[model samples]
Target: MTAIATVTHVDLATVQDGGRRGLAGIGVPISGAWHRSRYLVATNLVRGAEDPRQPAVELLAGSMELHFHLPTTVAVVGPAQVTVDGLPFGAGVGLAVTADVRVVVDHRGPGPVYLAIAGWEAPLVLGSAATDTFSGIAGTSLRSGVALTGVAGSGCSAGAFLRQGDDAGGPLRVVPCEDVPLPVGPWRVQSTARSGTRMVGGAASSSGSRPSRPVVVGAIQAAPSGELIILGPDGGLTGGYPIVGVVCSADLPRVSELEPGEEISLQPMDVPAAMQAFAVAERERRVVHPGVLGRDGSRRGSVPDDVAPAK
Candidate 1:
């Protein structure tokens, strides 16, 4: 068996994956990767698919570094420069490594970077490997000098959709709304927490704490002050805030990537339109880089067994 890498320095990082599902009725937060699509795509890039339950290192808005301990490939998600052995590398791409190689994360870029190994073998709890920051379910946030292990395997590969560039299109599209006022222009990210990303300059027609109510991943609740707070990966199973509108599943990636102080917008959309957008996004991602997860959310092939260190 081959050892993967050892964590040298970490800045507010944790292990995260697809997230827990189905326990919301009993009140369990769906603590997963902030950007689900990015996580899935990144994992699939390195492993040809995402296990959904496979854990990956989730880095926040700070610096983190590691030392590659074996021969394998890895992926780095989001906008951050990856330096291998003192050389600058691309973001949203994979890199090859051997024993004793140094990999550093230049967190100066717009972040929430995800670091995933080839054969993810992190410990799982409640059917997920994602770290529940709110409840500390699977495990606590990662600290410096810890060694993260992955299943040893043979071979190395690259992803098809390893394209370089950012997609700065129009405002993100959201589902149709009722009495809730349109977030007219760019709204700034006032702050981010495990529960949600609070936006400034929006008004909530009605606001007040109520009994904890069931909430899904992208529920956008409005405060009496009109400020909008979109649920994060660690969103509570029940919330007391009044939900004004819901963000479409297709735009969840960009929504989760919202950094504090950054400005963005949301446009109105319908159910059918939203579904179509999601379908299109999936197809595009696969077309660029074929993956293991399909429409039914099943893997194309059997998952490889985790290998132990060579005897």
Candidate 2:
């Protein structure tokens, strides 16, 4: 068995007092104590997973500051105008971290950017490692000098990158609540101005005048109104909302691939037909992405090289 490396420190001078208090209050209440320390990487480099056992750390040189929210954000800070191997780094657009490499993030600016580090474990209570910024259920942001441990693999591919100003937009799929009336065609998702909405049995609450409804992934019930909702992993376990429709389990991956603001059309199906479709989809997924399953039928943290990227 591999022992996970522990985080030793985090610096918090850049964050405001109110932010520190909020992060501490929520973090302590849930995690029992703050565990890991954070440091700013001076280089533009950020590393994800090197191995299932090793924890990833961001190294920022002087003059750079990081802003992050844990359970919300984790920030890292360091000196300004540092160099990685005598080369300039952190010139505006930051670099993505690759596995097994250490890079530096240096800044020429006078103020510091924030960097945060924490243990990454799967099976987070919510769908994300981030705490709900509104709920106060977890730490809202990262503080300097906090120690952490047990970070897990991010499971992202090597050399994969995300660029600033590049928007990955698409519609989120949701199943209709049992009690709510279904909508017809592709209904647009309205933005709720408020934050920190709580979810009950897979449904979310909105500060808006209308009642918040549960979101699930499934087809709409055969009714005068043909509507559907697609549920994400954070959906509540149970609810009073009627689930007239559900997105087929097979379509979940496709749904996951959608960018924000993209629309998905729903084709209705009865329960039995839905089940059959799910079965076929599962089989096909296994065949296409055999790396998804390890030899023991368990999930693998790193995908096998043999598997092709989704077309």
Candidate 3:
């Protein structure tokens, strides 16, 4: 086995404005050149009052500094502060590390405070790295200097880990999960008109200009009006709602790229056609980036080619 490096320093810095901010304003900043390292040592309580449930951890937003021990890639999912060897860096940005690095997250607002270290090993149950905070199965909440492991065999050494640009804003795509029946086209999304719109395990209610109602996909279900909640990889095994449509597994990445108030259009697709589309998309993804190719070679964004719009 390769020699594992231990965390040298950790800090619970306050988040300032305009670091590495993400949707709902959460994230962190990374600095310095680190190599052959592992682990994101969280040393502070990073909090996000705006989104208390989906607190900003591991992600960066403001002038925070983080140190690393090896060549690593950092992805910011929420807003945070960042620093490198005591120097300030830009917010909402992803950093590639090639040597020992230091990061600081200065808290700006009242949100959950946590730090995420890269290059650790954790068991994989689903297709995602996020720990089921509720189930306590894969991951748990972060504390000061907490060293949470990463996905084993990830081999994510040097490359762009962020799917969307730091400032890239656009619509979110949704096909329905295993519950929905029909292949829905893209739909527009916006933040909840009012606050107190609870997000159960990252499951937020969809609003504004959604796809046709009553989308059905195998075991998933959806309601006609009110709110449409799409299940993510960490979603529960079964539910009660009538899943009207299902987002193809291949298109989940597209959904992740969506920001609030963005428009998404969905094209209907059947089971057989959906499967074929997935296969084609996978091939295309590999061709675009051969290094990231996995054994499965499955695609993770957009609808498959075979799936056509409902006439």
Report, for every candidate in turn, its global Cα lDDT versus the true structure.
Answer: 0.69, 0.30, 0.33
Mark the 10 consecutive residues where model 3 has the least summed lDDT.
Answer: 31-40
Q: If both were scored by TM-score, which would come out higher, candidate 2 or candidate 3?
A: 3
Best by TM-score: 1
lDDT by residue (tens digit), candidate 2, 1-311: 12122222233222111112223223221111011111112111123321212122322123322222222112123223423234443222122232332223444322223233333332233222333333445332434333233343322222211112112233323344345443334443321111201111222222122333433323222322222234333223233334545655544434323323434444454557657855764343222211233323344556545542211
Name the regions of candidate 1 deviating beyond 4 angstroms: 1-3, 160-166, 177-186, 207-212, 287-311
Better of 2 and 3 by lDDT: 3
**Highest lDDT against the true fold, candidate:** 1
> How many Å off is the CA of 29 in candidate 2?
18
Instruction: Report each candidate's C-alpha RMSD, comma-separated, in the order given.
Output: 7.9, 13.9, 14.4
Ranking by TM-score: 1, 3, 2
Worst 10 residues of 2 by lDDT: 31-40
lDDT of 3 by residue, 219-267 (tens): 2334335344554332334445555456564454334334455554555
Q: Which stretches of candidate 2 lie over 4 Å from their true place?
A: 1-100, 103-148, 151-184, 191-231, 235-244, 253-260, 285-306, 309-311
Clashes of 3: 110
Error of 2 at 169 (Å): 14
**Per-candidate count of clashing residue pairs (backbone under 3 Å):** 5, 93, 110
